[model samples]
Target chain A: MHQIKTLSNRIRKNTGVDSIRCYQCGKCSAGCPLAGDMDFTPNTVMRMIQVEEKETDKKLLQSEAIWLCLSCEMCISRCPMEIDIPKVMDFLRQESLKEGLQNKSANHNIIPFHQSFLDMIRFTGRSYEIGLIADYKLRSKKILQDITLAPQMLMHGKLPIFPKAVKNRKNIKEIFKKTNML
Target chain B: MKKKLGFYPGCSLEGTAKEYSESVVSLSEQFDIELKQIPDWNCCGATAAHNLNKTLSLVLPSRILAQAQKNEMKEIVVPCAACYNRLSVTQYELLKNDQLKATVEQAIDMPLNTSIRILNVIQFIQEYILPEIPEKLSHTFDKKVACYYGCLLVRPHNILKFDRPESPQFMDEIMQMLGAETIDWPFKTECCGAGLSVSRTELVGKLSGKIVREALDRKAEAIIVACPMCHANLDMRRPAIDQYLEMKTEIPVLYITQAIGMACGLNERQTGTRRHLVKVIGNYFTKTRIPVENNENNPITVEEII
Candidate 1:
């Protein structure tokens, strides 16, 4: 119970999405592109937060809903109360990561992809496609997923071998340090 | 004097979506709009950062905005829709929340400036390119095009405020100005399952497949977009989309800048049309009724025309 309250307050403070403001309107779920794939619909996630049940809240954090959200902002666009459902999902995802909660639905590699993307940016101050793909493949062990497309991508110069690091990379590293991301 | 705007190409422009960056540069040059790249600009944190860390997401874009401010740029043009969304949303958030602004400034070690306006590719075109369309266009695009806004380009209507979030017409209107017939499609503002192109390939295929099918069903010769993610999914992920649909669809997904560049008499190479994975632009030129006289023997071969 205390955990649920702390989690809800943290989400509200971080995302500025008031769980109480969501009035069971299912417009978010209806407009969500990945609603069908989610373990909890967008509305259900919000309702779970409002209900303040610790187990359900933890389940919501561990469910595929947080990982599956595309952050397309469709839910907020259609929300009558302007509840930013995607931001809520983002907060839940951050919480899940901090708590080391692994999503039970492991079919998707979104978590690894997100981590790889951040790692790329943390290293180079910008995303390098080749490095990102390589890192993600190694982490997820799905190296064979897009092997066939490499030749075509290389031909078109879409996959550059070298990444151009930003000039002020020291400042970027300082940013990560100051934000406690390192 | 040429008008200059601060440009943030984002990481995708340097990587998987080089063609978009190329077209944007070429088209902007044609219009005499100088796009000065922001110096030492880092990643905008995109969809991934926000999901992982809120402070990092807000600080990353704020750093870029601070750089633009330092450059004395009044407006920053973000060609990538995802970058535009991140920058615009950060600006909106900073304006509304002083605590966030302070934290972001402290994190980035720079003074925060939320006044620097951020414009997406379409909005930039509507402002700078649309006015000069009549004088610039040498050949009319006589094919039907479906303008796909994807999601971030127009949604979160309160913050973006560029076009109708439900059914945007800025891209369609620009296409019409180039003499192309813009199709009225239902999925114009639909989500393309962005950032999931690599992680959840099957999901992107299903979502982008429906978008492609709708365009094809409406008899659109091509689908025009401004987002690099949309192009990557619709074009590079065509095989996956085909697998999901159990049918092959060869619709060329073009960046709006590419289409505009072509319509303005720029060669295929100049517009970076040769970089597309699906290869529909060649058929687009050959099938057009305008009869490009330069390549009578092989209108499909852009190199021949060049």
Candidate 2:
């Protein structure tokens, strides 16, 4: 458990609000859809706040709860204390990223997978699945990681070698040119 | 006549979500809201890209923004929540990081204008389309619905600042104007496990299942959504969720426009209600409205003509 003095002082400094308003009500935890999956429940995080223990560690940040949060703002809505639980979780995720404490689960391939998807869009002015998947596999340095899997997907007619492109790639490229964040 | 917007429809609207695009086009036409589909629009590279590379993830939408700047469409109307978030976050990053701007621009070969506004369909409707609805409403939906914003509609970034992100009533407000009963439920903007729907089925099933259960628990006749993925995951994936949870939840997850169309007295066929996975509008369409297809992608056929 976090020390009360440290938690209050941090809350006062960062949130510009006193942590004393929270009366250990579990409404936030109760309403949070991701709370059941969370390693640290909303109530626990709030309690930690009262105790003045603010741990921004890998375990805390990398936990599935951090990413699984839908940020629906339900917890705060139901909370009598009006604590922004989702915002706090977002802040923790940011701190975790800054401190390089991100959890890279086996499913961590998603991040790079997304990069490849973007790369295809950047180059072709739209999504090109074949290009994206190839880039993804290449970037991840997983040459034969899913070699057999690819054939299975192809056999199932799920994989398309020639992904569709937006008609007027050049005009789209011009749009990309103007935004400059391509 | 030309409504200036960087139109971001994401993956669903472009391909998998053809009905959403069709309805948006149909409704936009009725209101004369000229939506210039961004020339050469690309995938916003949703949940997948951001997970792989942060820069690439951000750059995907930045590329769209760059195009928007070129076209001079400062205000981007995204029909999809994931796309809206990507575009909004990219705009935030570009305004925040000059180095990132330079790199991303070089990659796409575009000079981003930086003055871009990402608006979701609901925001567009509330800001531009809703007020005009009173004049357009031809019918009324007395049915009670839970306006589910899901996760991406408003959060992290306030692109669509229509309502409180945690407790958004923007959809409810619109629903009220259209003469529908809006239920103030606890799971208004809850996550239906949208992003993980493709990658993690069981997890998304559980998440989506819970959202439906909440709506059913609240006795909402339907769930109105702005995000297509939310519609798909919650509505289309209901059977799986039902099996997983071992409960029969026949709640119809409707698009905000679909409900609005109903209230406005648009034909069920025109609103594409017939194409919905779960039988929606039940027997309501028979006595009130005739079926008509507003085929914007093609021409309106006589058979489709009501």
Q: Report the number of the highest-lDDT candidate.
A: 1
Over the stretch A1-182, how does candidate 1's per-residue lDDT look in tens digits? 44435567887876666788888969999988889988888888888888777787788878888898999888999999998887788888888888878695543499889889988889999999889999999988898989899988998889989998888998899988887788
Query: Which residue pairs clash within candidate 1?
Result: none
TM-scores for the candidates: 0.94, 0.70
Mind giving the per-residue lDDT tens digits that candidate 2 earns over B1-306? Answer: 655455766656654455677677667767777778777667776765444334555666776787777787878778887788777767876787788788877766767867877778887888777767656665556677888887777665344355676677778988877667888887777778775554345666798887788778888888888887788788666666897789887777778877766555556565676556555735332123322533223211112111
Q: In terms of DockQ, which candidate is strongest? A: 1
> What alpha-carbon RMSD in Å does predicted model 2 have with respect to the real structure?
7.5
* Tens-digit lDDT track of model 1 for B164-250: 999888889888877889999899988888988899999999999999998998999989999999999999999989998899887
Q: After superposition, how far is residue B54 of candidate 1 from its true place, in Å?
A: 0.4
Candidate 2 lDDT? 0.65
Q: What proportion of the true contacts does each candidate reproduce?
A: 0.83, 0.27
